[model samples]
Each structure stands twice: as structure tokens, then as C-alpha cells.
Target: MAPESTNPRGDLTSEVLHALSKSDPISSTEAFPGVPFESIKAALDRLASRSMVTYEQVEREEALLEPEAEIIVSHGSHEARVFEAVRQAIDGLSIQDLENKIGDKTVTKVGQGKAFKEKWIKKDGAKLVALVDSINDVTRDQLKVIQETRTHDAKILADLKKRKLLKMQKVISFRISKGPKFALEMVKEETDLTAEMLASGAWKTATFKPYNFKALGADQHAGALHPLNKVRQEFRQIFFEMGFEEMPTNQFVESGFWNFDALFVPQQHPARDLQDTFYVSDPVKAGRPAPASADDKHDYEAYFQNVREVHENGKYGSIGYRYPWSEDESLRLVLRTHTTSVSAAMLQKLAGQRKDGRVPPARYFSIDRVFRNETLDATHLCEFHQVEGVIADYGLTLGGLMEFMEIFFGAMGVTDLRFKPAYNPYTEPSMEIFSHHKGLNKLIEIGNSGIFRPEMLEVCLSDYQISSMKIETGGRR
Candidate 1:
């Protein structure tokens, strides 16, 4: 008959209990040197779960011999082998003859150099001859000692490691001790009470397992706003706190007139080219701009004529582009290239306030997506977000614009700003806003700001005899 199988974990648990009965504490490494570390930890965990025992983990680093060092320990050092081989031959041995005798070209070649360096061998013409009759292999002796003891002098260990003859490995063990519920034998315990146990009056004496309230429970995945939308919300809150109204920029498709002509952008501008703008196809064209509501009594026809005349010829004491502006081009529908198109429409409505009374000082802001025909790259994309703000009031100066920018950017923790002179089609004395970047160690352009020109405002506010108005606009991507 075959012998019965033994359970290592059960045997180890029982042995641990018996050992603990005699000693208050014991080390797993000293008691079970040959046992696997994982198995010992498992038995300890099982006993600890029942409050019968406890343990602490112990870690240490051990040095061991490499395959090459082991071979040297089993046989002899390379230099010693070469000396013995040469001495055994009455005459001398050639290079090929030495390799054939050793059956290893690498070992023969390395051994020959070491023997020569030690003055144990000399070159006798094309052959090698032994200079000594005997040798003691100190390398083999050191490796043998390390193989048995797992350690040696620090300098020798470092030298052996540098030569790729040894390596270090981490070893884990445990120190165990008895707990409050320590016992020689494990007793069966109930985890839950049943109806039969209750009816049999056994629930009163049942030893229920203790609940581990500290144990972590299952994770509950929750919904959250996207990172971009969260930032948009923060910008909106900032604008609201500054007494700015949000613009309706939900309309992605817009007529070219509101996008460019009313903004005083010429038809020959590079931004209107097919290479830069994404023109819509299905609708073919859009109707003339009209009132958004019947209550809005703004003159749509006269406003359209003023935009055409201003772009084609000089108007309101300004020299226009002098090119014949095409009405068909103005009506063509296209994807709005920037949120500035919405700002223009809002400004046009604000101009109509002149008919009711004096146009009030107003502030408007928008954070929305815009489309462009851009080459895809690390920094450029066809679709992206644009942040724009328009502030219109009487006697708003360039200094005021700069101060407003400081307060606005400072709210988001951005400071130390510098402005560079730039040119824009619709704004006079445009400035490119820049901020110092600590990471790049240079100034980077953050946005653009400028005051609106008379040519752009005249077409909208001309009906109320308002030739020009101070309107500041700032934008960033």
C-alpha cells in the first residue's frame, strides 16, 4: 500500500501551537529553515484570524554564488587549472592544444591570461609553458566557504559581485507568539446563527466569529463631470462674480455677414479662405440678418446696407478696403471659426438700445467650442474651445483694459504680465498679452486684447448718431 499524504500547513499549525506552549515566542526562520516562506505565513494568518496566535514579518538580504563561481568551487580556479594542465605536459602546449585539452575555448583563453599575470606560465615560442609546478586556488576556496555560510568578508563579497560571480537575494521570515485565545487544538466556531440552532436553544452557547469592521468594502463607482466642463463651470462662475452676462453661443452655423462684415473684417482677409475656415455645404446660403424677436425693433435692412457700404467704400471718416463686397459671399453659411461671431451679434443688439435710451455699459463673456481648418499636430486641432470677453462702456482706455486683464487673470492664479504691441483687423492699437512661464524660462503669449475701432462700431450704432464707442475685447484659446 502507498503511504498517506501529509498536510504541511496543518502539521505546521499544530507544531507551532505545541512550540508556543513551551516558549512565549519563537522565530519561523530558526524553527523551519527549509520550509517555504508563503506556507508559514498562511498557517500564521489562519491562527491569527481565530485570535489563537500573532506574528511579525522579518526581512533580510542573503548573498549566494553564481553558476560560474559554483563551477569554480566544484572544480578549481581558472588560473590553477591552467597551471596544472601545463605542468602535466612534459613539453609545452599550443593555444589550440590547450583549448582541446580543456574542452572549453572561453575557459582556456581566460585561464591562460590569469596564469600569465600570476607568473605561473610563460610563452615559449608559439607554445605556453608552466613556470610553477604547483598552485593554491584562493578563489575556489573563498567561493566554497560562501556556498556553505552564505556570507564572507565584505571586500571579498563586493569583488566577487563586481566579477559577476555572486548576487544578493532578499529573504523573508516571521516571529510568532501566543494570543489571548491561544489553544493546543482549534475548536469549530459558527459564523452565522440558523433557525434550527435557535429552535434547539443552541444559539445561546454558539461562539460566533468576530466581525472585522476595519475591513474595506466594495467600491461604488460614481458619475462625475468631465475635466474640461468643470473648468468651464469655474470660468462661468468667475464671470458671474464680475457682473458679466453669458452670451448664447449654442449656434455653431453662422452667416458670414455677422461673422466678418459687421466686425469690419475685409472679404480679402486670409482667415476667410477655404484653407482656414470650414464652410458649410448643405444649406448653400443664409437669409439676411433679422430681429431675433418681434419686440426687438432694430432696422435690419438699414444695418445691412451700412455694413456693405462701409466695407466697399469709406464711411464715418474712415478709408475702407475699397473692394466691391459681394452680397452672396456675406450670406454664405459656414461653421463659426470663433466665439467672436456671437460677441458681434450681442454688440449689434446692444447698439439697438440707443433707440430705447442711452446704451448702458454692459459686459459679456462666452466659453464655447469653435471650428477651424487647421493641420492636426501636437498643438493644433480642427475643433477646440475659445474663451472671449467683451466689455463696453464710456471712456474705457487702454490702461483700463490692462488693469481688467490683471484682475481677471489674477483670479486664476496667473500674474506677472507683459503686453506686446500687435495689429488686429477690427481693433486699434492691439496688444498681445503675455505671462512669464517659470518652467520654460521665457514669456509666452496668453491672449489678445484691444479696443474696437470706429469702422466696426459705426455700422451698428450709426442709426442713433453714435459715431464711435469704447468697447474692449479679449480672447484666449
Candidate 2:
């Protein structure tokens, strides 16, 4: 009969310790006769956790036969069969005749190859003949021994494994022994004071478990912001310090109209191609912006029409790209390739303010994710972040844009600065900014700066001068 447990968990621990005390080193399978193996293992682990018992694992590699090896055992091995067929024939058989006798293409092919390699069979002109009058089929004999004994000679096993006839399997077993604190008899430790023991004045002698101050505690996993978000917060603080209001950039998907057409990007531009942008498929198109209300001061619909007209023909004293414009193409949905889409929307809002009254000098900034159809690599990704800023006032110039870059990057300790002439569809006289990296001992192009083109701002803020700059800060890999 099995021993009854007083406390199931405590009794299991006690039983393990008791078994170890008698045997010194015992297999876990032999310790608990009636208990499930998993249950015994769990109890052993609990004991190990408390340092009351220790265990060593033993692993044995045993050879097992696969289906092909089984066939070799039931029938003869391929090479052995070939040797037998050759020896029995008075005149050696030809390759064609040998294949007919074997009846298996695999056996004929593999058997002939191994037989020749071992020199067990040699060619007698066109006939295959046994090299010796009598031969031992070593592979067949070894496989038989392994099948019966469930073990193998190391060298024999290697050949069998190479031929894929034998598989080596690892079997793990455990040896458990009493640890330093192990004891046959156990006293359940009281974790707290009881009212009955206190009233009877027995609490004074109650046993308690010793405190293990050296034992490590469970890990506490706490939430943390992503590294990009941390840098974004720092950037937000910098923007606030520079007295720039944060622009809302919650929308990741934008209509092609605002993202491209409104920015004066021609419809035929390659940036709108499938290779360069990710377009939304389901609910594939977005509703056009509502036309300006007749009574409304902002006149958004009027602005939309004016933007379309400018793209299709000349406007604002400039000859536009004289090409057909499609409102359907403008309504197509896409993942915004840049945060400048947000800037475009904000500029339209600023235009509405201009319509209401005199335009106030304003500074806006954004830090957020943007997507592209880029092939991913060590330094480039399909999606990344952009730190974008725009300042709108009367008479802002390319010089004002340059000064802002110096002060902004300079505040972050980037003092060495150089600018080169560049171009953008929406920005005239664009300049690419580069900063000297002391560690790299070279200049790295950091960002792009330019004054907003008259064509882009004609409808939005024709009355105000605007300059914009965008700096692409690389994203997490």
C-alpha cells in the first residue's frame, strides 16, 4: 500500500527526501511507485527549488531502425542481396540481368554502388561477379544485433547513419540525491500566528520557516516606452522650448489629393508609382474634401477647385504642368509617405485663418512615422520617421529657413553645418543640409530645407510667405 499524505505537497517533498536518505542516489522513476512520473518530477522540482534536494540528468543515445532499415532486416540489406544473387549464379549476371533478379530499382542502384565501393563485387567483362567465393554481410549482421540489443558499435552505427538506415535518439533519465538540508522527517512550518494558538499561549513555541534573504526574487516586468517614442518626447520638449505648436498627425492613411496634387506633385511623377508608395486596396478610394460652403469663410471646396485648375493649367502668374488631372486619381487612398502631408493640411487651415483676418505669425512642428515602398536593408526601411517644421509669416525667405536649421540642430550640439543646392516639386530653391560627424570624420546629409513654392501656397496661404524644412531621423531597425 502507498503511504497516505497529510499535506499532499508537503508529503510528496517528505517522501522524496525519505527515499533519498535511504538510497543516497536514486532514479526519479524508482522513487514514487504509485505516483505518475510527471507528478513525481514536479515534486522533485519543488524540492530542488528549496535546495532540499539535487538532481543530475543522464542522457543515452540509442540506435533505432527506420522503415528502410526494417526492410533490410526483414529481407537482406541491398548490398547483401546483390552479393547473394551474384554468388548463387554459376555464371555471373549482367547489370541488366542483376536488376531483373533484384526487382527493385533502388536496390539495384544503391546495391551496385555500395557493392562496387566495398569491392565485394567486380565486373567480369559485361557481367557482375562476386569477388570472393563466400562473404559476410556485415551491415545485415550489425543491424540484426542492434535490433535485438537496442545498442550499436560506434563505427558500425556511423555507417548505418550515413546510409540513413539508423537514427540515433537521445533518452534522458534523472538521478536524485539528498541535499545539505534534506531530512527524513518534516515539520510543517507555521506561516502566521493563529488566534487559537495565541489564546492557548502555544504561539511562543510554534516553529516557522527560516527567512532566505539570499534567495533571488521573481522578476518584475514593467512597461517601458519604445526608444523612438523616448526621442519623440525629447523632440516635443525641444519644440515647446522653441515656441512651436505641435501639429496633429494622427492619420497614417491620406488621400492622394492632399498628399500629392495639393503639394504640386504631378500625377505622372514616379513617387506616386506602385514601386514607391503603398496604396490602400479595400475601400480603395477616399471621399473628396467637401467643397467650400457658399456662406462659409474658409471656402475649402473653392480651394480644392483652384488646386485642380492650377495643376491642369497656369495659375498665380505661373504656368503649371499643362496636363490632364484626374479627380479619381486624387481620391485614391495611400499610406502617407511623409509627415509633410500633415503640414499640407495645417497650411490649408492657416489659409482659412488668413481669409478670416490678418494672418498671424505661426510655427508648427511634427515628429511621426511615415511609410514608403522601400526595400529594407541595414540603413533603409519601408517605413521611418520625419521631424518636420514650417514657419509662416510675412516675407520669410530661404535665409530664414537656413537660420532655423542652424539654431535647431545647434541646440542639439550639431554646430558644424553645410548646405548644398537641391530641388523639390513643392519647394523652390531647395537646399540639402549636411552636418560634420566628428567620429565619422565626414559630412552626412541630414535634411532638406526650402521656401514653399508660390504654386503650392497660392490657394492655401497666398497672402503669407512660408518656409518649410524636413529632417528624416532614421527609425529602429
Candidate 3:
């Protein structure tokens, strides 16, 4: 016999070893009677950690009463109710009358069928007559017994299950046994080699805990860039390789003037609808762009007049949208819907340079986040990144745009390129770009490209040629 100990760990370890010495195996319930199984499991785990015992879990089926079955056990089965109803009647009631007395349709239907099958009742015309003097409900009695005992008789349990009166659940139980280092008693194991023990010459007799070299250690996580950032980096590198200057797109907040009006997009365009664009409203207003000096104010007024005329009266051998352009609407602030806003600003700066007689050929590119008010799905998001490129020189054409795209995508191992006819408000002769997807075995539309329309270009420059294209990407699909 093992000595009883007050320490729960030592006591549990000793009990398990003692039980295993007598019986080859013992269940957790059998070893720790009247104790919570979880507490016992915890004690067993501590012992197993010390390599003094071990356990194997087995799944067993347990029977439990369904809600309806419990009601039957409490109030008596439907057949029992029918039998009692018949006994209470001096002259047997008719089938319809008995149904009225019972009220429950299931009880009426099943009870009558079962009573007739057992010859406990017989039909006399429309009336039901009791043929037996007394009856017993074996189903109800068995269910009550099962509920009280929490044990099952195979045949009875199967019958109740077929009737949907009992449900079976899979429960886990532990079968524990002695480990390789089984012992009748447990001693506290030291986890460290203390200086006090060494100084007292007690290190030689200390029972140190064993080390488990095979045990897994905590995961070591290091910082890494997000998938979108990695792709953006690759795009940045490609832009650098192509001698394209990076445009500053740090301004996520922009006025509708630069976002749409300067781009020659109509005020009433569907893209400006609340359903498609996210409008900012905390301050509820954005300050107007102030001029640097009186001369700057005069220059901006002239530019503003030209943009307003282009939207209302058309310009440069083209018909404008011929609608009222609202200065208030243009002043409204929003989260930028595209990176092209930055390109628009850069174009304005280029226009000022042209005024100063210093127009220079330039290529600009930007990759930045944008927002929209749209329904989200696996293939769409409310916010995403936009990649844009602009070229300003003496003579850029639609053909030049196509060639530029070919070279740009070719650097990334994408050789197969297709351009489909498309439409945009600010870009004429627009085309949607596609690339062959090997894994998908089809051509997938990748982005959009086109030469900027004259109406959009006239607002930015007067004596220099310019072409711009934008692509929306970095959204989950």
C-alpha cells in the first residue's frame, strides 16, 4: 500500500501507480471516484509530464433523452394517455370524440394505431370500444428506468433510438496505466541546480527533473512585409528600371476639384455618386487651395476659368459635356478614388513650368492606396491600390502607350498581352489590358490603358504632349 499524502500531485501519482500495480488498466472515473474528471485529468497530465504514468483516450457512445422523450417520461407516453382516456369513459367514445378529449394530434394518431394493434381497443362503427380492462405502457416505463439509472439495455436502447426518443453522443474517456518509470511513491523533482545546494554538498543527492529534448519549443516569429507591400516594391523597382520618376502620393485626402474636375470628369458622372465614392464629413468642409501671392492668385483664376469652360463649353476642337459645373461640388473633400489625382497635380506643376519656358520631357509613376464606397466581396474591396504612369514630351501617341505597356509587363515574365476596346470618360480610344494566365488557362483582364483626351490635357499643359494610363490592383480576389 502507498502512504497517503496531502499534496494533490503526490497523492494522485501514488494512487495511479498503486491502481496500475493491481489492475492492468483503470479508467479516470474508476480511479478518482466523486472527483471532477477534468481535475483528475490535470493531475494525470502532471504525472505523465514527469514520466511516472501515461494515458490513452478512447471515445465511447453515451445515450441521452431528447426533449420529447423526457416529456413522455414525465407525463406518460401517448399510448398510455389513450388507454387511460378509454378507462375513464363508461361507454367508449367515438374516434373523433377521443381525439377531441386528447387534444394532441400525435397522441391521437399514434395512440389509436398502437392501441388497436395491441387489441386493447376495437372499432365499433364510428366509436372506439375498449377490449381490455387494463393496460401497461412498456415504452414509457423503460424510458423512465433508463433516465433514473443512466445505463442502457442494448435492445431497449435501440428501440428507443429508432423512435427518435433518445440521442447518442460521443464522449471521451481516459484509460491510464503505469509508465516506464513507475513507482509506489513520488518525490519533488528540482528544476534548477541552485548555488545553495552546491554549497551544502547536496547536489549529488538532489532528484533533478528529466529533460525532454524532443518536446517542441515556442514558435519564433520575425517581422515581414505584407504581401501587398512586396508587390508594390517590385512595381517600384520596375518603375526605377524604366527611368520613371516617382510621384508623391502621400495625400490620401483630396478635393473633388483635383480628383475629378481637373481630370475632365463631369460633375454628374455615375462615378461621383455616393454609392461609388467615399465622402469625408467630420470637418464637413475642406479649405480652398490658397495662392502663394497676388500673381499666383491671378494665374490660378485663369486656370480655373479654363477648366470651367472645358466642362461647360468644350475646348480644343472637342464638344464639352455642356452642363452646369458646380464650384461647391468641386470643393467637396473625399478620400481619393484613384492615384491619378497625384498625376493631375503633377501635370498642373508641369503647366506652371511651361509658363516659365522650362518645359522638360518627363516620365512619372505612382503606386498608392485609394478608397471607394462599394459592396465588398472576395473579388472586390472598399479600398485598394492604384498604379499609374504619365509621359510628357513633344509627341506621345496611342501606339507609344501600347509599346510602353508591352515593355513594362515583359520585364515581369508576362509576354502575352492583349488590349480590348474599352471606354472611359477622360480617355478616348481606351482599351482594357489582358494577360494569359497559365494556371487559369485563360486570358484575364489585368488593367486599363489609354491616351489622355485633349480636354484633360488642355487643363494641364498648353505646349507639351502628354499621355497617361492608370491600373487598379492590389485587391483580394
| Global lDDT of each candidate | 0.81, 0.80, 0.78
Give candidate 2 regions above 4 Å deviation: 1-206, 209-225, 291-297, 355-357, 464-477
lDDT of 2 at 361: 68
**CA deviation > 4 Å runs, candidate 3:** 1-221, 291-298, 355-358, 464-477
lDDT of 2 at 338: 86
lDDT of 2: 0.80
- How displaced is residue 82 in candidate 1, in Å? 87
Model 3, span 175-199: residue lDDT tens? 8878887777778788999999999
Taking the tens digit of each residue's C-alpha lDDT, what string does model 2 give over 228-263?
888777777877998899999989999998899888
TM-score of 1: 0.54
User: In candidate 1, which residue ranges exceed 4 Å CA deviation?
Assistant: 1-217, 220-222, 463-477
Q: What is the lDDT of residue 358 in candidate 2?
A: 63
